[model samples]
Target: MWVLVFFDLPTETRTERKVAARFRKNLLDDGFAMFQFSIYMRFCASRENASVHIRRTKNNLPKKGKVCVMQITDKQFGMMELFHGQKEVEPEQPSQQLELF
Candidate 1:
């Protein structure tokens, strides 16, 4: 499972910029990696685990911007095509996650 967070936060003022930076930091601290400037993604062992991160992301959302959270299966994510200029490139692999019972 993958939990993808997309956000567009206001950064017009110093305070707003600080708030946006803090939000990104929180996402990173919670194990999400930057997929784009405004997109962060994390791999989870299960749907339940993905839900937990989604909740955490919701809890940290800024008061003045748009935020969207979505989940995708590994197969769906794999079908995505990435490109740099005119050349195609492979997506970076997600790190292996180990679960202990």
Candidate 2:
């Protein structure tokens, strides 16, 4: 599963800037990679794992901003189409193989 996080946070005031920075840091600390500006993505081994990360993201939401988070299966994410200007770009690659204990 893929946990997609998209946020638009206010950066007008110093405090807002700090908040936005902290949010981005938190996402990185949780293993999310920057898919684009203000957008982060993480891969989970299963739906349960994705849910846990989603909950963590929700818990650390900033005070003032728009945040949208959703989960999609790996197959769904794989089907995404990408383009860079007129040239077509390849979609993002999935994470490393899952580990089994």
Candidate 3:
């Protein structure tokens, strides 16, 4: 699963930079890659991992700043197929057994 995080915040003061740097460091530590300014992407093993990353990122941001996190599976991207012509795709069925189990 890939998680995309978009951060939108005002950088009016040095304090803002310090806060942003902390968030960036935390993201890098968690295996996130910088997709763009204030945006990051990460490959997570599970929804729980994505949630934890989002929570940590949110905690690192300034109180006034805002963050958006979106998680999508590879199947979802394949269904969109934006580069190619749009086609109807059958929804994927859930696995009968958990991978961990």
Give the better candidate number (1 or 3) by lDDT. Answer: 1
Candidate 3 wrong stretches, greater than 4 Å: 78-101
Q: Go through the candidates in order and give each one's C-alpha lDDT.
A: 0.92, 0.91, 0.71
For residues 60-87, write the lDDT of model 2, one tens digit per residue.
9998999999899889988888788898
Identify the candidate with maximal lDDT: 1
Worst lDDT 10-window in candidate 3:
90-99
For model 3, residues 38-67, the per-residue Cα lDDT tens digits are: 888876667896788778866676676788
> Model 2 residue 16 lDDT?
96
Candidate 2: stretches off by over 4 Å: 97-101
- Report the candidate with higher lDDT, 1 versus 2: 1
TM-score of candidate 2 relative to the true fold: 0.90
Candidate 3 whole-model C-alpha lDDT, 0 to 1: 0.71
Task: Give the range where candidate 2 is weakest over 10 consecutive residues by summed lDDT.
Answer: 91-100
Highest-TM-score candidate? 1
**Candidate 2 clashing pairs?**
none
Count clashing residue pairs in model 1. Answer: 0
